[model samples]
Target: MTAITINFNNVLKLSDDQFYQLCRDNPDVKFERNAFGELIIMSPTGGETGKCNASMTADFIIWNRQTKLGEVFDSSTCFKLPNGSDRSPDVSWIKLERWNALTSKQREKFPPIAPDFVLELMSPSDSLSETQAKMQEYMNAGVKLGWLIDRKTRRVEIYRQGQQKEVLESPTSLSGKDILPGFVLDLLFV
Candidate 1:
């Protein structure tokens, strides 16, 4: 099903607590808040998409476990970005120092910080342009590196701060570059 976006600007804007409560009240629905205070209600991913997401998350988890350089989060974790948008990247990582700097309560809530690196895998129901825009938003919010992986097209769009997106065609793997240092994403399963 196509995700539904509701414009909440006409209504009294919800406070941060109210918004978080709304999410808590609906445990099954996935929700996102845009910079404009619009609410995005997304449908659950299909089986194939879930499998790919799990693979990607596993890779990040393994890398983080070995390197002990940062904290890794799956798709369920939402982050309150500086621009006042709450976003949940498919896979995200924050530097060790940055993660340690957050207060326990902030860490428990949507930790108000942009991730150092993020990944977005294209699902069948997702629109490419929308995903691209989301990646750009991440970059604008101070993400050091972001990857928009399109399994169907066998392509990847790499987003980085202070640079244009770099596209790659049908690569076997993706290097983490300077940001992830020594980390690489194997695209075979993707």
Candidate 2:
């Protein structure tokens, strides 16, 4: 089979529902828009490209969930930011009761709400400025907590409501103090 060449300049259009439905059929595709509406498609990172780093993120979220603490979502989905923009975080968690507050339809939509916490790990192709901007947007939109995980640096930039930005390295615990009680993410070594 011939490889498909992606022309980033071309416009890619889809309604929010179209994008959600696409996810069900093709979990391997990742979508993002440029300044224009062109939806850039790339194979979702996996195997070696998505190895240790992404899995570390998964491990953290899973630990929280298995402890029956929260629900987690990965980059296989997108979200509506309060500023009327859309974004995809590497991993996120919604406090159980708050998430269950959604109507069936609301749950089916773009989740119309922010996660109690979000974790974004840098892929090889991700840009620092872009990822940081995303974390800021999430916080400004009332997201209680956010983490920008640097795979290459093995650190995370932690964000919280009404606080200064703090970069944490190893041996520090990632906490959801206000948003998630009894939650401590000890992912320094990861």
CA lDDT, every prediction?
0.90, 0.68
Error of 2 at 85 (Å): 2.7
Best by lDDT: 1
What's the residue-level lDDT of 38 in candidate 1? 91
* RMSD of candidate 1 to true structure, Å: 0.9
Which candidate has the highest TM-score of all? 1
Model 2 — which ten-residue stretch has the worst lDDT?
1-10
Across 13-50, the per-residue lDDT of candidate 2 in tens digits comes to 66667656765677666655333344556445545436
Tell me how candidate 2 scores on lDDT.
0.68
